[model samples]
Target: MFMDLDALSDIIVLKHVGHGLTVVTAGVDRIELAHPLTEICDLEYSGMVTYAAGGSSVEISCKVARARDEGEPSRPEDLLLTCIFTMVALDPVTRKPVAIPRLVCETPDEEYLFQAGAARSLERRTERKTSLLEVAPDDEESALIHRIWLQQLKYRDRSHPLRQPPNVLAMSRTQLATAAIMQPQYRNRHQTMIFGGYHLKQTFELAFCCAASFAHARPTFVSADPCAFRSPVPVGSVLYLTATVVYTDPAVVEDDEAQDKINKDGGDSESPALTRVHVRVDSKVREMEHGTARVTGQFHYTFTVPKDVRVLPNTYEEYMKYMDARRRVRAGAKSHRSLPVAGRDGPNLTE
Candidate 1:
């Protein structure tokens, strides 16, 4: 179910010795090869994950990615290597990923790992079918939710305790969306699609703006979900990345002493009183002519705020977003676990 990352060094050896040319593996996604062997090895897909159904026709994304030989590359002989965090399976097949590659697992445990990933992809697809932001011609549930939110505005008293006072700090949903398009140059030449890492970085940048504004300060990087590259963002497509501050620290109100101390000390580097917020980002894209945005990726982040800012959700929709964020965070905490890999960027599950 889990492995010491050091075992990958041996597995990489087995690849050259003929078990398989490529290691079909489930681990932290990184591209590592031996020296001199690195000459023609200019592919820089660090922490990129590709997940697809076993069926044919896997589409890869080519959005917001560009080739840059900026970071150090890994070699087989390197004493310590990154991206070997969690090895549930490995594939030795020699073929390249024309479409998304299916797991060519060697054992039940390996298949088990791959299956779990596939299941997650499926679950995301199902959720995307009717996300709150998605527009459908006849989506009754979505319409109902919207109507219910609107109805609350007419019936609820303005002076009620359920809503934030007019003078309280708050954030608007208006600043949450950014519109952009994917270009041909963003894709990998060989694969003709965007690298997962590139998409992730770009998405994080957008989320940072939303989180920073909502937190009223710079937020510390916590962790992100292992990318489940849901679908490809084709070249020449418009992209809409929505970053929502779903939840803000619920503590700063009750413990003014600690909040004041943190505010003064700037959230002591390791202090538990650090203001925290959960931000969720969804990647959506559509054809240049089409108006509807389909979900491409789902990412969640937890950041510790450095300010004593207050985020009051003033409306039904805003209130629901806060509550939903809290629920998801709770669910994630229940199922999350971490493995101590030697050189991991982020754990497959959580850190």
Candidate 2:
């Protein structure tokens, strides 16, 4: 008995006792158990044969790095050995395909954990030290690449089960001078351009630039956010990006004069302009079995604007107030003192 591709693909999800484990129990699709049962039994036997031959079972173990769990927020979680299934050739005696169930193990490896922790630590250090502007020149090619990525971020929907369509949310930019006013690190003569393109994960780096330019400040181009996709985007989709200052912070008003100096020096401030933009993205089912089973995806992001462009005053003020309140709350919490309780004797209690 031979199984067709669709029949072979029909895998059953089964629960295992005592391990909180789920296994792909093969042969559930068969109306008559004899053939499928034999296939499954043979699969287990094959595992035993492989173990005898190589001193280890021919089992592929994949750690579940992220999975949907009930009653938990939609966020990535640590890896766990929660699922186990064994695959082997069809029974040699019967010549039919089958899958076997293997006991899911909870053996945690300390070495793997330490290695993963070290890798994460290094990544954090890199993110803190890496300056996006330092890696690429602020040339036309760089801007073009940034523009392409911005567009991709705005338009391309990576086919994720949980995501949303792309839409225009916000946009802005920050220059070296403006950035210098906020942080002392950028005060040197070198110019740094910041371009942000946001879709979902809008907080992550969509694209950024810090570079020298030779053009005067001018509105060379502008466009609204693109349309949203009706379907989910596949993973590894090329994201296009382009950012322009939609608004700027008022604190860097003085830097406008510095921009003027660059203009007077015959250097064009137009080419290597800094920009930040917020984009929307739509999420849809890339693959589905039933018509009603769908995943809920989200699209929300914030872009960093330069400190010169005139933004909606009310919005900017609200943001500032929110930041101020948050700071105050944090500071007050740090300074808070606990009151001493008096015991029955009218004296402070001591441990």
Candidate 2 has an lDDT of 0.24
The runs of at least 3 residues in candidate 1 whose Cα sits more than 4 Å from the true structure, single-residue gaps closed, are 1-168, 171-174, 189-191, 251-273, 314-320, 343-351
Each model's lDDT comes to 0.47, 0.24
True lDDT of residue 10, candidate 2: 18
Residue lDDT tens for model 1, 1-116: 01222233324333323343332222232212112122333332222122335432221111111234558553323312223222222232534442334536555544444555
Q: What is the clash tally of candidate 2?
A: 44
TM-score of 1: 0.51
Candidate 2 lDDT at 339 equals 16
Write down the worst ten-residue block by lDDT for model 2: 44-53
lDDT per residue as tens, model 2, 75-181: 22222111112222234345343344433322343233223334433543563353232343335434433443443353346663322111112222222111011
Model 2 quality (TM-score): 0.18
